[model samples]
Target: MATQIVTSEANTAAVPGEALEFDDIQGLVFFGHGHLKYSRYVFLRMKDGKQARARAWLRTLLERKEVSTASGKQHPGLKDVKGEHALQVAFTYSGLKALGLSPEVMTTFLQEFREGMRDERRARILGDTGGSAPEKWQVGGDATMAHVVLVLFGKDDADLDVFHASHRDCYQEALEEVFIQDADMRQGDTEPFGFRDGISFPYIKGVPTTRGSDALGLPINAGEFILGYHNAYGQYPFSPRVPRSQDPGNLLPDVPRSQRVSGEPRPKDLGRNGTYLVIRKLRQDVAGFWKFVEENSRDPDKSAEENEANKELLAAKLVGRWRSGAPVELCPMKDDPTLGADSARNNHFEFRDDPYGVKCPLSSHVRRSNPRDTLVDDPQESIKLGSRHLIIRRGRPYHDKFADGAEEQGLMFVALNTNIGRQFEFIQQTWMNNPKFSDLYDSKDPIAGDNYDPEYPGDEPKDYTAVVPGFPVRQRLTGLPRFVHTRGGDYFFLPGIKALRYLSMERTP
Candidate 1:
């Protein structure tokens, strides 16, 4: 998450509530201290309105979701109620009831969470959240909320006692208070692998595309990442496109207008309004990563002056951004705290600006992952690529530093789109993990690669490295281990708010 120091003003503006219903819910389980657990549920609304279709999806979900123990038994039983085509996976959380009702049972917990946020606001007011002005952070809060995100971890562990109190404990305490009624809620972080998780996500196709609005950085069409499908009114509004024969289930069209793909000439009775969802649980290796970074960046025989500069440069390239969180495109020569902190300028560059690896290596992680303006040499090509490559990264970092350190600590990368196959995976397999884009398959996402060698750490000889022909001969940064590791993940469809009411009716399968 970009550190934006926002002002502490409650939303006094009376805005209408957005319809927040989905066909399925994908929940991630985070286990920690004192058997504490954290979970995040991503709600998906499907694009179709056929009750049978919704029911079909639920059956498939239950059938495929069985987990057998060593002795072959399970805890949660699968039950099916009709009017299907929606999917939701409920994971463990401590605070479900506290989210809405029963103030007496949860007032104190809610109050504490409120205090934590207020504390953050006060810090912002006192100039602590990092930006010089509120505008520098830019992104809005309501735009950030899409799924249920929670965090939970204990503070007394030997390793955690240090930074836990200093850095992470605040977030943990805030979440606990906010979701106090649900004792099952836990804090959610990035996948433990720590790949700057949630870099690329699919944009919904067809719906109007909002590149950089007041709320979210970019409001892409929902179709681009949901089912690898686009909505019927591509690049247009959805309110006017609904069929005349249908009723708006339990959802109000006046609320958030969620439309399904309905451009094809279909019968008038068809209903449209839903989307898809994908859930994943990825693990990160924090201890091993720090160990590797420390070991590889140092040279045994080289003088400190000779080695230190190269070491720092390589680290910067590996992450594609400086430690200050500034994208290398703008601050090519070095990290610029001012630029990194500027929302208008920080994320606004393509690696093409720095062709020679001077400010940023051609193979920098962020550049390679998001070529941005790099792919197109021509101005028109660059513009086209910008529209296609854009994605909304809505996720946060999760770390239980004091836990056994054997597992769990990273990002919970969440993205919503109409098409999943093309956008999200393309960024992962084609851009981030792909090597051909680099020099002769020499560079990939150093932080996300599965195959790693314990040996060979250092910079490639300048003469040996080659990204271009006769001019810009770049050296490759070697010895860095992949930072993000994928343990497991799955894809599910999130139906719309209207479809949700349709399913609540409970028909026989």
Candidate 2:
């Protein structure tokens, strides 16, 4: 189901650990390749001595996790997946501390994860306000600190029912969980805004098919997403190190830290077979978003038929794709749902041909986010640069009626990357939030970014300009406000099974 690419990295080298441990890793990472349907994102806090007791409870829960390898054989018993229930567990830095992990180990984490995402200034940059602000956020906010997040994937509601029963039965010890919030999977892969998602995933180096991802010869360094491997730099990503004495059982990989061009040692290998996970709750203003599209879509002199056509055009330009998930570059004039439904035809378009900002605007959501040769002349260089900023997203939509005084729904934005600063944060700040992106003046990302024009600062009328290409006169739409905003989010580390077991301190090899 992957689009064909002429470029392939045939000589891409790989690190040790040929096969990924399905049980140790969470199935969410692979996107069920397409088998999974329902998902429950549960965030919980450690209640006092719950860490010690939770460790034991985690061991019991591990047995029920449905892990699969490269071969995705479906089980007939399950309605959605051919496999059993899928589960993955991750602990935030605070959660790790709650588990009694020493400060020495904790100090090695990234500052973004340590300091967190609560500052008002940063919130403004991320388009986080209203339902997405920390005040209304459920987890990883100033109000609540979640220690662990358990992602459970089931075939259907019946499957989730069974999971709830198992969770209750397994945790009879009164773990005193501080708080728990659940984000359910929507019926379709579409978000609340009704745009089709879960397309455009990266291809891994060693692992051939991640079910849902393309095995394009353009294989990315697995270390970019996983620990203990060669990254895009052909060197191991910077990770934490511990004394050999701490892991005497040889459960962890013996890899050097602070690797440059050559393999070198730093200290502990706490990051091997693990990746940094960023979880953010972004609430979409569904009504406000569509209203903006309708009001500003037409020119005063345009005919009724022309105005109706322009409405969809305006909305599609914002996302760089149609509601059917078709890229504007491929279907610039009209949405081709047939082409959009086909993965091969959907994502196989280039922006180099649209230099004058006609087909897809430079500041459009997809273009700003990925750029993809739109930034430079050489496709190879663009691909190489894009590879560095690539991230594996495991996000799902959440719904809560009458939330924030409105029907509340947003994406549980989860992503995995070796370098949080370089990958996730870079995209949010340098690309998505930056008002001036790729030579565009006074316009931020049309959808995700806050439409903040610095020229008209503080209480003045602020508006964003979108230049739509045309034959006679290019159409310009202005006065756009922020649509999507961040409510709450935090950084956590999703450890491999071995790493999780090692964190438990119960299974010593």
Candidate 3:
């Protein structure tokens, strides 16, 4: 049975942005978990033998064991203080640069994550997976690889400029020393994959006084995402968790019935603000994708240039949104590069006025990812879904090789949402990965057609209807093969500011 969410009636206060003073330019490190004591212990280990002030500051945090909580039941139904991982840690980019160590030196001298004194109490931080793989190392395309590499290795600013200039040998050597020896934690935003990815992050209950829309289309509450239930005015805000019917079929085997785990958990408490981030280094087969398009164009009899145009059109249709970011549901044919690049209007529309794939095919990546108003067309249904399917995607593109030939390239797909089960996976398996969208019919997501016809018993028929309203109906082009492939992934919770402070001090108890 799926666990039910228990709404809390506690009133918590929020802290204003001014009160929470922190530099955003610096790179930050985030770690999340259930216990404050465990977090502090880890922090102590992380900061050991560092600057005296940093060490002393960490010592002070250890002494301050308790972090504020809202009714001690952060998210009324989804998670609680005990089962909840501490959900801690945030290190500024500059602060990391101030660590005062060279990447090469630190990589060689780094201590294991566990404390020397408490070897029996191993830090659960080391997972079986995540971090760099020997054959496929990754770096964010949006940010400089040198910067990220240095940050990951904990090199201070004094060495950054020199190292970045001509330390490839030193840098690569150090990176291998650290990454290859032990699995280090990795972080980065998602790429610009035409859809608004992270907009749906759950507001931290006591953090993120910055008001924003979440995937569920509701106002973000600080108390819902952080430990302390305080507001911008330094006042406690009260909002009761709204309960809904529990679906038994949603539970995975071996998952405890006592703990509710679903895709859409209500963000009703402060500590619930931090979202779990799952990062995957996916390599796209761009050449293969285009080749499939070329062979499958309806107008093969046309000139070579016409054939190429048709292939590009097919690519646009599958993605549902142009590379420029315009939704095909809105601009079906030619891309409005201006609109796609505009943040103000890029993610603002839905496929309501025009369904039936007339403008955007139902199977377009964006459309399938979030059917938006199309799935539940009725006004009331739209209202319900409007609050749902919202996510803030911060991703960057990556290529297999720097200059030219080689194979991989695509997105460093990073997605942030209040509820991973509800938002991310729901979009992946149910929408993008699923061939059939509810009762609509069978169709593969154009961008990710992994399950093009996973269960079709008969040989795929060459004759098929490729129709879109206002466009000429065409016959299916000869052949097309699956292009995308999933490499690996795991879930992680991003903690709030207070959580980070607590983690560094080794103070959970």
Top candidate when judged by TM-score against the true structure? 2
| TM-score, cand. 3 vs. native | 0.52
- Provide the RMSD of all predictions against the true structure, rounded to 1 decimal: 17.5, 5.6, 15.1
Model 1 whole-model lDDT (C-alpha atoms): 0.36
Q: Can you give the lDDT of residue 3 in candidate 2?
A: 16
What would the per-residue lDDT of candidate 1 be over residues 148-249, giving only the tens digit for each residue? Answer: 232223222332234233322322222321111111113322233332233232223222211222112233343333222233234322221223223334
lDDT of 2 by residue, 1-509 (tens): 21111112432333233355433444455444345566766677766655667777776654543333222343221123346566667888777777766666678676666666665665665555554567777666776767777676677768877885677566546344444445655457787787887777677764533223331225688778877677887888876555556666776766553442253333557777778888887778788888888887767899998887888888888888888988888888788899788765566666777887688878788888888775567876777777888889877788776646766787877888988878987888889877678887777787777664333246222556665665125766677666676767778887776666667665222
TM-score of each prediction: 0.51, 0.85, 0.52
Name the 10 consecutive residues with the lowest summed lDDT in model 3: 22-31
Ranking by lDDT: 2, 3, 1
Better of 1 and 3 by TM-score: 3
Which digits, one per residue and each the tens of the lDDT, describe model 3 over residues 100-166? 3223212321132112111222111211112222122332111211111111121222333343334
The true-versus-predicted C-alpha distance at residue 271 of model 3, in Å, is 3.9
Against the true structure, candidate 1 reaches a TM-score of 0.51
Q: lDDT score, residue 89, model 3?
A: 27
Total clashing pairs for each candidate: 82, 11, 82
